[model samples]
Target: MSAVSRLWRRAPLWRLCVYGTVFFAGLAAFYPAAYLIRAIPSLGKLHPGALHGGTAPDASKPGPGPGGNGGPPGPGDGRISFLPLTQGLTRAVPFGGHVLPLPAGVWHPVLSAQTGPNGAMLTDVYVRTDRGVVSGMVVAMGTAQPIPDPNLLSVDSPCHDDRAYARGELPSGENVVSCWAIGATPVHDAPGTLNPVVAQAVDRLNALGYPIPPLFMTMRWMHLTTVPKKGVGLEQADVMLSPAAPGTIRLPVPIDQWDRGAIAGAPAAAHFVDRMRVWAQEWAPILERGHAGTLDPTTIPDSLTMDPAAPAVH
Candidate 1:
C-alpha cells in the first residue's frame, strides 16, 4: 500500500490514465463475452424444443378454430394409450424340478407379429441381463429369409441374427404354440441337493402335456467378476423362455423368484396359486374351450417330493 500510494502521488495523471484504460477494456470485453456465451447452443438457457422451432401456441391467449394446428398437443393430450391384452393367456405351471415357478404372460404382441424390413415394435417382457437393458429395434425382415436353424436360438452365446422376423421366413400360423421356453440357463448354488428338482420338474411337466423343449433344458453357468459394494450383486445368469408360441408351457413363478428364492421355501407353491388365479380371472373363457383339446389341470403335480439321497438327473 505504501509503495502504491507513493507512486500514485508522484504520478497522479499517469495513474488516472492507466485506470481509465483498464476500465474501458473491461467494459469493452463484457458485451462480446456475453454475446459469445449466448451463441453457444448447449450453454444458452433457451428451451431446447422451442429453440429448434417447435413452439406450441399459448391456448390461454386463444386464436383460431378447434381444428387449428395449435402446434401439437402438450405432454398429456391423450395422444398415447397403453393397454394390456386381456385375452388368450395360458396358465402358469410349476417349473418341473425346482422350487422356482415359470414366468406367466402372453407372447409379447410385437414379438408375435410379423414385421416388414424396417418396421419396429416395443416388447413388454423386459429382462435385465449382463448387457445393458438388451434393448433396441430388431431388423424386421430382409430381402431373403434366413433358414430356421436350431443353433440360431442358442442361449450359450450371443444370437447372430438380431432380426425380429427373418426375411422370407413363414409364420407357422399355429397360434397354439404360444410360448417358446428356449435357452434356460440354470443356477445351482448347491449342486448335489435340490438342483435335480428342476430337471425332475421338467420331466413331470412333459408327462402333464407340456412341451419341454430340449433347448430349454440346456443350462449354462453365470459368472460375476466385480465385487459388489452394496446389496446382492446380480450375476450373469438367466432362464430364457419364450412366452409366445403355442403348445409352449409357462411356469407360474415370477422372474424374481426364479432368480433368487424367498426366505421361506414356498415360492413354488405361491407361483402355482398365482397362475391359477390368473387363469380363473383372465383366461377363463379360452381355457374353457381347451385350446389344446381338454387340458387336465389335475395331472400337474403341486409339489416335487424327493429323497435327499436321490441321484441327480443331469
Candidate 2:
C-alpha cells in the first residue's frame, strides 16, 4: 500500500471525508473571494497619487534610468530636455501593476506602494492611485511573461507570450501591451534577415550553447491602448536602433508605410529606442543584477510623489 494510505489506516477515521471537505472548502472560499474583492471599489482608501519604482521616474526630476531621463541633461533653465514621458509621469494608480501611456492631465501624489520581484526574474512595483492599484514591471526577456494579441502588429521578440495569465487588466476595460520598448529588435525573432554576418555569428553562438540575448536588456514597458474586450494583451514590440555603431540614435522602424517622424515628439523616444546598443555592451553586469535577487520595491518613489515641487508625469 502507499505510504499515505498506511498512515491513514493507522490514524483515527472520524470525519475523514468531512475534514477533507472543510479543508478544501476553506481554501476555495479564500481564493475566489480574494479575486472578487479586487473588482469592488473602496472609498476613502489611501491612493498612490504619484509614480513609484525605478522603472518609472518622477515627472519633475526629468533625470533618467527607469526613474529619470535616459539621456543627457536638458538646458540650464529647467526644461530637462528629455522626452516628455521620461521627464515625468501623468500620475495614477495600479490596475494590476501596469503602466500605460501617460494621458494628458494632472496626476496626484501616491499615498503608498509596494514592490517586489516577479516571475521570470522581473521586478514588480505596485503603485496605489485614486482609481486603484496598478503594477509596473522592469521586464527582462529571460523571465517576462507577456500576453500577445493577434489583432495587433507583431514583432520578432522571442520572449512574448500569448497566454491570458500574462496580461494585467483594469476594471475600466483598458489593457496594457508590451514589447521591446521603442528602441530594440529581437536578435533571432526578426522575420527577415538581419545582416548575413550577424545571423551567422548568432547561429555559431547557439551551437556552442549560449542563448541569443533577450530584448529585455534594453526595452521593457508595456504600451497602453483601449481594447474592445474586458481583456487585452502585451507583446514585446520592437523598433530598429543601432545603425552598426555605439550610441548612434536611429529613427524608429515604421509600423506601416508612413513618414518617419511620428514619434519624434515623444519623451525620451530617441534614447529608449536606441538603448539596446549601449545595453548589449553592459549585458554581463545586467544579468548579474537580475540573478542577485535582492530588489526592494517599498522605496519605489512614494516620497517623490508627495512633493508638490516634484514634476508630475500627468
Candidate 3:
C-alpha cells in the first residue's frame, strides 16, 4: 500500500491525460486501416482492368459512355422502285376470247405483201372471242398477180369462196399466192353466233388495212370452211388449196401441234370453220394484193411445224 500510494502520488495529471488520449486515437486509426486492407480485393474485382493491364474493353456491358456498331438497313426499310420504256406503245388484242399483248419490241404494221423464195411474212395475230383470247402466228405472203372478185365466182367453180380464189383457183404452175401458217387455240363457250362488237372491231381492222379476212360473218361465226383444213390441220377437211391444183386455191391453214388441254375451252370446230370464212374475206385484199411482207413471221418461230412427228397438214 505504501509503495502503490507513493507511485500514484508521484504520477503527473497532465501526463496521465495525454496517455489516455493517445491510446484512444490509436484504436480509432487501427479499425479504419484494417477495413481498408480487407476491402482491396473486392475493389480490384470491381475494376479488373485497373489490376490487370491485359484486360479488353467489353462493348456489351453498360458503358461508362454510349457506343455501338453501325449495321445495314433491314428488310422493312421500304418499297422497291422500277422503270419501263415505251410506256404508251403497249397494246392488248383479243383472240379466241383471250387477251394477249405484243412482245416488248413488236409493232403491228399496215398490210403489205412479199415475193420470191422468201414466201410470206409471218406475224402473230390476236383475237378476243367468246371462248377466250386466241393467238395465231401467221406466215403471210402476197403475189403481184391480180385476183378476181370473190363476189364474181362462177357457179360450180371450186373458187367460189374467197379462200379458194386466194389460194389460186387452179393447181399447176408457180401460183403467186400469200399463205398464212396460223396456229391457234380453240375458243370455248363462245355464243353460237358472233359477237357483233368483235365483228365490227375486226371489220374496222380490215378497213384499216390489217389482213383480217372478211370471211368472218360475225364475231362468233364465219362461213369459210377451208380455214379448218388450212389452219387447223384437218387432212380430209378439204380447205387446203394446192399450188399444183388449177382453179383450186390452196388455203393450207397449218396449225401447230397443240395440246388438247389448251383447246378445252375453245370454240366448237363448226364455229371455227364458220369464222374462217370471215377470216378469208378479211384477208382477201391482203392476199390478192400480195402484201404478205407486212407479216413478221419470225416473231413466232416456235409456232411453225418443225417436228417430223407432227402431222403433214399442221
In the order shown, the candidates' Cα RMSDs to the true structure are 25.7, 22.7, 39.0
What lDDT tens digits, residue by residue, belong to model 1 across residues 74-162? 12111101112232222332111111111232211111111112111101111111111111111011111221223212211211222
Residue lDDT tens for model 3, 80-184: 111111122223332222223232222232211111111111112223211111112221111112222232111112233332212223111232222322112
Query: Residue 64: error of model 1 in Å?
Result: 68
lDDT of 2 by residue, 1-314 (tens): 99777767777564487588899875443332212222431211222221211221211221112211121111111100011111223433222333222222333221111111211111112111222211111211111232233323332222243311112211222243322222333344443323221233234334544333322122333333434553222322111122221211122333221112443454343343333323322322222222233323232235322221112321
Q: Look at candidate 3 and tell me the lDDT of residue 156.
A: 17
lDDT of 1 at 296: 46
Which segments of candidate 3 are over 4 A away from where they belong?
1-134, 140-267, 290-314
TM-score of each: 0.17, 0.21, 0.19
Q: Cα miss at 194, model 3 (Å)? A: 29
Higher-scoring candidate on lDDT, 1 or 2: 2
Of the pair 1 and 3, which is ahead by TM-score? Answer: 3
Q: List candidate 2 stretches off by more than 4 Å.
A: 1-260, 265-290, 294-312
Name the best candidate (by TM-score). Answer: 2
How does each model score on lDDT? 0.23, 0.26, 0.24
Order the candidate numbers by lDDT, best to worst: 2, 3, 1
Lowest-sum lDDT 10-residue window in model 2: 74-83
